[model samples]
Target: MTTTSTYDVHTVRAAFPILQRTVHGGKPLVYLDHAATAQKPQAVLDAIGHYYRTTNSNVHRGAHALSAEATAAFEDARAVIAGYVGAARNEEIVFTSGTTDGLNLLAATVLTSAQPGDEILLTEMEHHANIVPWQMVAQQRGLAIRVVPVRDDGTISVDDVASLLTERTKVFACAHVSNVLGTINPIAEWSALCQANGTRCIVDGAQAIQHCSVDVQALGCDAYVFSAHKLFGPTGFGVLWARYDFLDALPPYRGGGAMIDRVTFSGTTFNAIPMRFEAGTPHIEGAIGTAAAIRWLQEIDTTERIAHEDDLLRHTTAAMTAMDGLTILGTASHKVGIISFVVDGIHASDIGTLLDNMGIAIRAGHHCTQPLHQRFGIDASARASFALTSTREEADMFVEGLAKAIRMLR
Candidate 1:
């Protein structure tokens, strides 16, 4: 961790125009629901607008100059994203609609290799995006599904995962970070374990990508998936990075325009690695915007921004812990900036509603991890998640607003 000497929260917040807006009753908005989708900065918005104004053309099809320019920009975005995630090569990166789309794509193609009685292993803390796809695939493939249970503190142990893995386990899908609990799972060790057990390891990195630097090669997972919206980029765009060999070996998820090569009425052959996975006209502007967002974040002092977020987490956590009848859901030793809590005898919805009335945005629900919520013996929780641009003042406001909300509810 480094000191926040060069990073200024106010300066960073100014880059996001949404931060300056007023919500309910003329109150200033204190946006804290970053885990849902981060607010985009002006740099990303400018990039998208510039692309539409100057270079709006389909890629890889036309022989004209505009098409050539669009093609170069799109591929350059891929290279930038690949480097940001520490992928071994650019060809391994496949653009998808979002994380859910990527996971479903992998589930459909990867599970085709499993036989009856083959197992698909997952952790109890996975988001529905990670769980439902594997379940759908297992049902189709005659494969069994197994889950590694989370401990009381909302953390999963490597040993628990090892105990569950067997020769029959064909795939291990887990999250790099828990969206609700903020627990950072041990991905590297688990990936190594999956390799030793001859199981393919897939990581859901939707929640982790914005907060931490990801190295798919270092983690040694067969595939990693995340959405661009969570990283202050546009929604409806994401990246799925797999080992080039693994991706080349799997069948294509969907077949259509760009994914084909030498198509004819008699027979058709598919294109190479990434294009084979990306079937339609790609999100050309979305790619440009995502690359711009990644570049904008890189311009900041990473260590200082990380320290600032950590301070927000510590301050908010300490304040919430001191409140009566308030219980934080997850107490994992390591976590990102997300914090979920429940108030005694008060519905989580009520807390969120009152917070919204006070012009504070927070999320209240199972957060797409109903199973994890069930494990915690609750149906829903109030979650306040932070981003790199979030301020200590906003965290203080949340703590203060939450206290008032609890009082009024009580």
Candidate 2:
């Protein structure tokens, strides 16, 4: 179970109880869908359960000691995440339901300052979370949505995005890493270009945060968005870290109890930056768990972890590509430990089903990048995304399962 010169992966695997058992019959679960959602580790689970059992209370509202404790822990979690992403201030980090909610909140809030002729630039490799919210708002505001094209190798150039920018371009948003293609977008380069053009830059870090280090100030994006669950935390929790300048002026996305300051029959005032955007009772335990996930990540030698993942990527790519008629999609040189492939004359869903029967979980279909799939002339592709605990054996199992599936299908 030891990978590379990296630390013991078996030790890491021991932290995840679910990795212990087999799924159907005696088949070990080769969970390769980390890009979709990561399995929570024991630290995350313990943090959440401990919170609900020991300090359950309504944060920022209640008067008692339990409430104060919960509030402090929740805000502390925000600070941890803010530091993790290198945000300028803790107030810049706003908690949302997930990546979908974070992107929607940001898009809605920023639209409050939009004019009729504004343009929002997005890349073709963006997840639907980054595309749909902008599309909905653009439709309503008469704004235009322009896409930065992806290359045949599943990578994008900053020059391509810059070519599309103009005086009318108010915002440029892109995913830091593509979920399907695993292309690592040059966010800092594009952010610098957008800033020079007087445009706001946003980065969707859902896929990037888990794979590599992300410093928002270093990335120089006006805003950044990511989900905690994809990084080994609880679902229903995400972070949207915006620049300090945008935090004060962006309008609130929802109206509810905690987000408001004063209410009147005629008009109501709102709370400060983050609280204004985070409405209703927040997920207190979810926040705590997310902090634990980040803490666990920090505990590991990240260099070693990344090296292990890179080894997995290289191994999987070689094994899968060695099979005849099996084509690996998105052969970007800078991709992370995710492999998307298609077997000729075989359906992706069938491959997924057969793998599932073998206790192997992978993502199938377009992976929410239908436009990318369309560009590649494929309706779907089978994706096996690696995580911290992924090993050479699991990679071999995945390739062997797919080979068996392809033989049967053909």
lDDT of each: 0.93, 0.89
Off by more than 4 A, model 1: 1-4
lDDT of 1: 0.93
List, residue by residue over 100-136, the lDDT tens digit for candidate 2.
Answer: 8988887887877688889999988888889999999
Measured against the true structure, the TM-scores of the candidates, in listed sequence, are: 0.98, 0.98
Reference-based lDDT, residue 41, model 2: 92
Worst 10 contiguous positions by lDDT, candidate 1: 1-10
- What is every candidate's alpha-carbon RMSD to the true fold? 1.2, 1.3
